[model samples]
Target chain A: MSPRPETAAGPAQGRPRVKRFARAEHRVHRATAALMAVCVATAACLYLPFLAQLVGRRALMVTLHEWSGILLPVPLLLGLASRALRADLTRLNRFGPHDRRWLRSVLRRRGGRPAGKFNAGQKLYAAWLAGAVLVMTGTGLLMWFTHLAPLVWRTGATFVHDWLALSLLIVIGGHIWMAYRDPESRAGLRTGSVDAAWARREHPLWTPEDGKGGRGEEE
Target chain B: MTKDENPARPAGHDDDRRGTPVGRRVVLGMLAAGAAGVAAAPYLQRAYDETLGAAAQNDPTGLSGLLPAGGGFRYYSVTGSVPDKDEHSYRLTVDGLVRHRASYRLADLRALPQTRLVRDVQCVTGWRVPHTAFEGVRLATLLDAAGVRPEAKAVRFTCFDGAYSESLTLEQARRHDVLIALRMQDRPLGHDHGGPVRLYVAPMYFYKSAKWLSGITVTDHVQPGYWEQLGYDVDAWVGRSNGRDDVPTT
Candidate 1:
């Protein structure tokens, strides 16, 4: 069999057109992440009281808490409803043999490309967060509008909302650290594109140069 | 829960980070957070003073608004957006049962008649804001307008958010004092207090005060909304239900 085209440099043409996400898609994702963080922080501010001795203003904390609820979810809804994100998510969620090979190399320190367009961890995080945001919206709506249910339902939803928020926060804390600490990961989000070298180094399998991806423009 | 084998303890938070050793940043960071928390204590105390402090003053009617001594209304919105509508554009609809099927804008209702009642606004969550001023269209007035049917046993209420739904027993809906509130403390409902129109049941826990209320459907029998189906007492009267033996709702 012939060697793969990706294993070699681009065929004498100019730099291949990069498969960059649209500007709006990047804007929405970053906005949602920031808003979600605000919501979690405000929620912590309000919950700290019941968890311990009161830590902040009940009214002020409550006021901030309420606004955060409205503020945080707007960006998420904007992102989810976007046609671009929905499509990008489909590719991001897929798992394939290339993914497995990448995993082994990671485990063994053997020298093939890093797994798939994204390692399993990144895919799992994206999918799980999507589900989490959806759940939070549903349960949160039930809570804010207590009259929609009998008294018991409202109370229970409130309890669940708080617990889920706490758990999500712990996970999100790690996500932020990973994105910020890893220079390559943060670059993709900051500029709707990543340096070819950076992409090859972190997600070698995803690099168009690999020609591993059968799908048109993106590898 | 896991125990912290080496929990960081701080002393009064007076230390300044000048030429602090880089190696001790983690400990210093913890100290900073603790100090900030202490700094926020006064605001928490102030909020309690505004709420429970008012309740302690002179809530004779045992209503849900702030006492005269407390100085303001401070009902909380977990998500914080309440309609707080003005009289000119406000509207309340009663549908889902009977033949009359009508919609009354804020003006039409205000013109019909008004009733005022003051009662305690106790929350199942534990805090009680007392003697709140509630005034508006009594349930009896609206129920009469729609003309309840023999088959109807409950009324389902939906809000602007489109997710929350609440139900009221036919009997409860007809209570002479049960109201669809237009005003609280002589002013229109504000954003924080379930503005525009919220249910004002003087004798029940505060959850019954559904904020941003939009739709009302008369049903054959009691079908609990989000909360009731989950397990909160359908008849959440203060101290009367919800398995808690705390102060009475009224």
Candidate 2:
């Protein structure tokens, strides 16, 4: 595929735009984010003594936290029906030579190597979070259904669930901080599109000529 | 208060026993050995109850209560450490809207015909210890002995644990399954399990089974318990109230 010119102009500003995320991708991201927010907020209310006392609807909080966590994977699973999302997920799964270079540059605090649709850091975060969520769900189910396992297993599940949840909260905070630092990435997530210039500058290797970029032409 | 009073001992026996330290090394050793099979050793469970569980009871933050101890039950106290009540000092009082107000010591309670129930203990927060055995005098038996007045519609339970109370309608209180649980898991209830006595409401969530039970007062209406006052359902029936659907413990 050759690098194609952006056809759809940005809303109001009229800057040329390229599709960075599919509608399914955007919706999945948003749904997951919303559920994650509920989980974190309810977890805080349940775990923090001051918060638990201040917001004393603990039963409600427990229900909300459990259901939100159980439902966290639904959006991504449903989004897999979309070919665009599936393709993006494949791209996220693979780490090329450029990704290793990008990681090295990140560690060195220097300019990053040319990147594709997702950078090495983004890939690692996505992969780590997916594993964390899966482990949490397994451990959470064990904690909830205490009879399904022995006492030691249940105790261990609770231990892992509590600690992993704390780590998830911290990692999510960093994810939000990074997202806040990058307006283009945040806008792409919000609107399913990005300025063609921003895409070319930040993810040069993702341009259509490389065959791994998001839709270079506006969809 | 009772015909069986022993005048030799002081009344404040429970007060004197609060915060009595258990040997930490002995408890730690048992904990390590018990880690292999916690459910198998009742003595280890008792050691944990007297040490870590007792210490946790005094923790104002209640975080330590979340630590997995006492076999399966979590340690929860609304107030700091509860005073220890033993066979000699422990007394259960039955009053309020009753024809015969009475006080019974541990022996008096144990002398009554005992009922043993094996049922799942379910917590509203979603933990279940299945097929657990609790043996004690029936709450109904006590209510009947007290001769509840016609106007009395409910029974309020008070705990020596301090700041914890629970209530059940007279009908619910009289259920054959409801017990003034003196023994759990085929052993005399440990301190951490709300011994020397506790209420075991078999059909309801575990919170309804108030621990360290000391007083039973027949009342005119349902008074919300400690957790209920903090927004837990007053009628915390398993698989029914609290928006939960766990298999009924009954």
Candidate 3:
């Protein structure tokens, strides 16, 4: 009687035939991430039309916004399923106690506090992004299927859809500036993996705990 | 519009963190979800089939509407939630200012001469599902049965769903591609996609194609349909409105 090699895997080990991040994975994420940015921002641009009044640019804003959203899930799904993107997101989602302190200090405007894994700002941003994306998807579908929902629901959905898009743009704008301003951070997603020293310096709590979602710390 | 305002970038914290290598399980789970959507297509089609009749052709209703704005067309019910397939439960009525008011059964509609059409089904949302086949009684036939008063210059569409409504000008209502669809994709109407009876307007966006269609009332003037009242175009000529610049598909 022999122990089969394929059957040898345990519940704890997880699926090995599946892969983690690879170089090509990084390339895919870079491209997809760029695309995702375009759509979410475009959605934000439409915010003014909804919040105030539907003006000249409002129509263009809305069309671009929707098209962008429709296209966004493509990258997200691709990235999530992608070995590289999964690895990237997994690492980003991780968390630790230092992240807690980061939140506390930021609240106090206390500068230069060393944080573990993703800081509070990063976690909040990630969580907001995840929630907004889901909301957008749901409302977009409602907008898509006119007969599926009532008029009131569609109106409300459209209202929230537009405002959330605006808020996303504002927040995402700040994020991009911070990234581009800081070369090290921007380099990470652009090239797939980040520099080793960059990781340890900022993400002291960084670890590949699989499902711990440590990188972004539960965001 | 600002250069610094790039919404597409990854929203990291004020500081940065390094991502650990990913686990294999996450990848497998995502793959499974993808495979499921693909595998479910056939069963979904069957289920879709069981619910609604075809859209006149194997394609969308838009193809039929593409008939030169003055052509003939058809639409059908295609959902499980529709009222009923036969004449027993169907109700085709004409309300508003009309000299000859009446309600007809499904058998009554079949008794009338039917027309057929082929067109491209376009969505105001920017997607165009092409080459739809539709079969239905000409709206003119229905309008004649309902009888129009001189004051009437509009028509309103009400569906069994009661959630959606649409309006057309007297002229628009008289167009040929506009049909009270009895069949779609050449099958009996289904319920999920608005079966038993749905309106098919070729060349216009699908929203103009109301599902669960139940009522047709001739009125005084143009009134916006369900989606049109909610930031959608009532006319919905492909690539003309709904904020997109998509090229019109014939």
Candidate 4:
């Protein structure tokens, strides 16, 4: 294959492009990812025995983990200010007949329906992650400020926080794997745009007759 | 034959007043639960002990400290490593704002009028070991012997580990519950437990009961302890402070 285009900006020898995400959306995604990475890395150092021993700044690690977890939702909250992100979030929230067909097709390992800006799987993942992050933050706060709740509640919070964190790591791993398998999707996230032909093939419902993807473009 | 002879006795009096026996299913279920608990006991205990050990050494993940271990107590060392001090090498000094500054060897402390206090040891992080017996000379006794000057307002504690420090108001320091602890659980304190001498502030959070304790200095004012300096409440009275509602240990 010829060298892949670095960005979906200009048509490379006649390849048209469609904007998939606004700049504000991209910043929100990046900031959230960075904070999540910090939370996960610090959590590993704090929880895993070998890593804890090897790293050995227990108190500092505790502070970092707590702060990062607390800040994990800030970017998404701020992103609501961007009209483009808000519209996309609305789209991601609604499920149509096509999305149900898409889900059935994935389960059967066969092609069935065209996807919109986000597929059924993507919508489910987004919703699951949003709920997970909120729960994690809630439990994290309970654990951090032990005085806020009773001993039983605090104990339950710790248990939920730990198991939920493990689940989140696994789910995030799957997300990364899927992203790696789809370069167009990665490009859409990284450059805020994607090839029109690729969008038509993968998300035909989102690509209008003008070859411009709707909902995610800056208003 | 005995039943035949005692005809006046009620039939089934040996069984139950209602003449009903416990259900076999219920008994079996209870037996199974007990058996499962017995079978799982070792693993649970091992996990608890190992977690406590890991925390004591260095718990970077901070989560291990939150675990309610089997032993009721967990070790925590801020400096990661503290050199062991035995009776021969141990020395505790009472100085600062005092008319007669003095240093006591471990033997001298043990020879003094020893008072034993049994109370729950509470960590501000929320684990508690109930009814822990701490034996040593009362800190007030030392302050009295040292002849603390009228200018003294607080007592600052320094540890041999060279990193941890704690302070208490002079009034708090004089509480009968406060001790320059030498023994714990009726045995000589272990290195992991901050032996041969450690400060035990009975009513305060365990952090105020500084480990590897080496010095008691009468100071002009309260200087916050190690954890306090790191944002923990300076006056960490179990239920009264730290916004926690734990029942007062005292």
Candidate 5:
């Protein structure tokens, strides 16, 4: 072997550049993250004061919060127009035997098994975040169009909307923590590619051959 | 399911072996969350009530305008100061395009048949005070008493607050739910609550039922109220206008 690229898994230098996430996958992730940051910030600004009884339903702040929340899913829907993202979604849906081994390694604080494009934890988190976004939108509409739902749904929506907001904050915090700890992972997210040696070492079971993914055969 | 019961299990496979700890963590997390939710329930209810309680008797902060008030009410005066009218000095004038222009004293209006109605008072800003009772003479009763002219198509309202004004179609003005309210919540209207007399359009948002009501002018067309001039709808029907379908308070 000539040399291996310096990856978070280890320090050897020069490996082939292999695409990990497609351009569309990177764009979707980046845009969604940026939008969610603003949404969360606006929510914090609007909600904290009301909780503290510092202000009532302020029109300007409330309008910003409402519109930002309503528009959050736009990027996700627009992102789906990319076939690469659609393919990524299909890949993210399936959990294989390697995923179970990866989870076990995570629990044991050791990298026992290498993962494919997405590990089990990542897949679970994506699924959870998608569900959360749906819940937020549904509840938000109920609150906005108050008379559109019955009293029970209105009240229930308020309760769920608030609690889920807290949970989402926690989930996002975890994501940031994981990204901060792994610079190579962050780099791959930025460039949409990883060193081939790093890919083999980090995701041993699913390395693509000359950029053609060996997905079904390996699984 | 014991690990040994399945003959296909690989000798050193750890996949199923490690699931126990992870599953235990998930169960424990759920239990903790449930406990926290239960413990926080009462505080949530109390906090909600305090933060969004009924409008204060004399809300100086004006926060009430933007909050729901269950069985509460708010005091808003466009003129900054409310003009007071007692039994001896109060007058409500019905004029312009009317065959019979009329004025009545507080006691004189009180002498008319009083109609009591309990309706939800909805503000355009999204606050609602439910089941609020208003007792007074009906607008139609007064219009009938004054004799509305056939050519009159709208009824314009002017308030003692001076700056605020509202109007409704003659037909809307004649709705059974509309009242020239003399009392609210079983008490004579206090000045803060637009006492002496106020217009109460039961099926419309509260602003259309102008506070400190002073004038009911019959006109050829509708004149937008103070808020309407600032972009509120001229026809502020409950659960209908203001670009929202809030549950009808009535």
Candidate 6:
């Protein structure tokens, strides 16, 4: 048989096509996730020990937390430089009509609607995390550069930063649990690819496309 | 006030009570050790200050402020060591842009009517010592005695440590709460606590109250303090500067 054409078309006339996340998208996702994990872990280490004085290691921990928060945006900023990543960002920004249905279905313990590359829940999570990171960065900077803001602003920033930090912890926990329950979803993040059947089952609306996350040519 | 003419007696007096007869070599060794201890005390205190500050910094939660002010209070000196001054050597000079240039010894300051203020001592770094009683001659009295020049807009402070400096506008300097604090917590101010004389700007962050105060210079304009030069606010009203309003310490 002739060598299978290296295209999104198909392996043959009868074979099912396998769509996968683009390599760039996968790389950006993994890098962003890793950066976020580092930031969250550092923040946790610094804040979880409520009695830092008793621990007698507060200065080092604070410095670490400060630096990690300052650097949190770097990975995503770099990833946004990728055309593919930017497109993904746009997709994540818009919550579709199906998203509410998908959320309702998830709550009902049943699949409600087909999703694209990302479901409504995933999009909302990404959006929320992005917003949270922005808030954290703004408030953290205000706290770090003491003279940058007035006392009232600083006080407000501190209160908001602390509350948001706790909220992010909870949100991240739920996200991890969801990922844990779905091996294929985790595989998509890990290897940048998922089986066509898994993708179809989970995200029924996601279609194999030329440039978007979809079927790749047979190796 | 008794002059400490025999400074060496106190430095190594504890070591001398070991009960051995003073041999020639032992005497020389005792004198040498006393001199070294005196020289090293300030630096040793500075190290202790650094250790405490480091501990506070290491705490990410900033709960270290709740920790006992480490041996009653935090001790910090910009200069590693400052020479001790007794009554005879200590002089607080009020000069520069003043009509009446006055110099005060510790005795002269003590003779002046003392005003007591009980206010919270708040560090810009977030630690606070609450309701610290500081008794001293009113800075207003000293300024009135000096007759501040009409052109003077601010008061500049210089510390005996020769490094730390602070400033306040003439208006701020004259607030009733402000004092040339000579005593802290009912005791004569210890050297560790900016003894003999320290500016106590009760309403402002502690940094505004320059420690080891030696000179009060009336300047035509406000002068940025030691910490102010390094990004701290010139007017560090408690709960206002350093991007924190933990609570009004005062």
Model 5, which residues run further than 4 Å from truth? A1-14, A50-57, A108-111, A209-219, B1-250
TM-scores of chain B, in order: 0.68, 0.72, 0.65, 0.73, 0.73, 0.72
lDDT values of the candidates?
A: 0.60, 0.74, 0.58, 0.75, 0.69, 0.69
* TM, every model: 0.43, 0.54, 0.44, 0.62, 0.47, 0.48
The most accurate candidate by TM-score is 4
Q: Please, what are the lDDT tens digits per residue for candidate 3 over residues A1-219?
A: 112223222224442221123454555556656667666555434322222222223345556656767676565665554444454454345444555567678788885556544555665566566656666666786676766775445544554554455566678788877775666454444333344455556765454334322123211
* Error in Å for residue B249 of model 2: 24
Candidate 2 segments exceeding 4 Å error: A1-11, A208-219, B1-97, B100-250
DockQ values, each candidate: 0.02, 0.01, 0.04, 0.02, 0.05, 0.01
Candidate 6's C-alpha runs over 4 A off are A1-17, A50-57, A107-111, A210-219, B1-250
User: Cα lDDT for residue A83, model 4?
Assistant: 78
After the best TM-score superposition of candidate 1, give how far the Cα of residue B197 lies from its true spot, in angstroms. Answer: 1.4
Give the lowest summed-lDDT range of ten residues in model 4 chain B: B13-22
RMSD, one per candidate, in order: 16.5, 21.2, 18.3, 18.3, 11.7, 25.8
Q: Judging by DockQ against the true structure, name the best candidate.
A: 5
Model 4: colliding residue pairs: A46-B60, A46-B61, A47-B61
Instruction: List candidate 3 segments past 4 Å from native.
Output: A1-219, B1-86
Q: For residues A1-219, what per-residue lDDT tens digits would candidate 5 score against the true structure?
A: 113334543323333566666566666677777778777876765554333133323344456677778877777688777765655565455566777888898899986875766667876777677767766777788778866866555555665677778888899899999887766667566666666666777766554434632111210
Q: In model 6 chain A, which range of ten residues has the least summed lDDT? A: A49-58
lDDT of 5 by residue, B152-211 (tens): 899999987667789999999999999999999999988767778889998888888887
**Tens-digit lDDT track for model 4 on B1-250?**
0112235655532111111112222334433433343345446445655666445436665555433342346556565567888878888999999999999999999899999999988877656777899999999999999999998899999999888999999999999999999999999988878888899999888888998899999999999888888788888888888766677889
iRMSD per prediction, in order: 19.3, 25.9, 16.1, 23.4, 11.1, 34.7
Q: Which fraction of the native contacts appears in each prediction?
A: 0.00, 0.00, 0.02, 0.01, 0.00, 0.03
Regarding lDDT, does 2 or 6 come out ahead?
2
* Inter-residue clash pairs, candidate 2: none
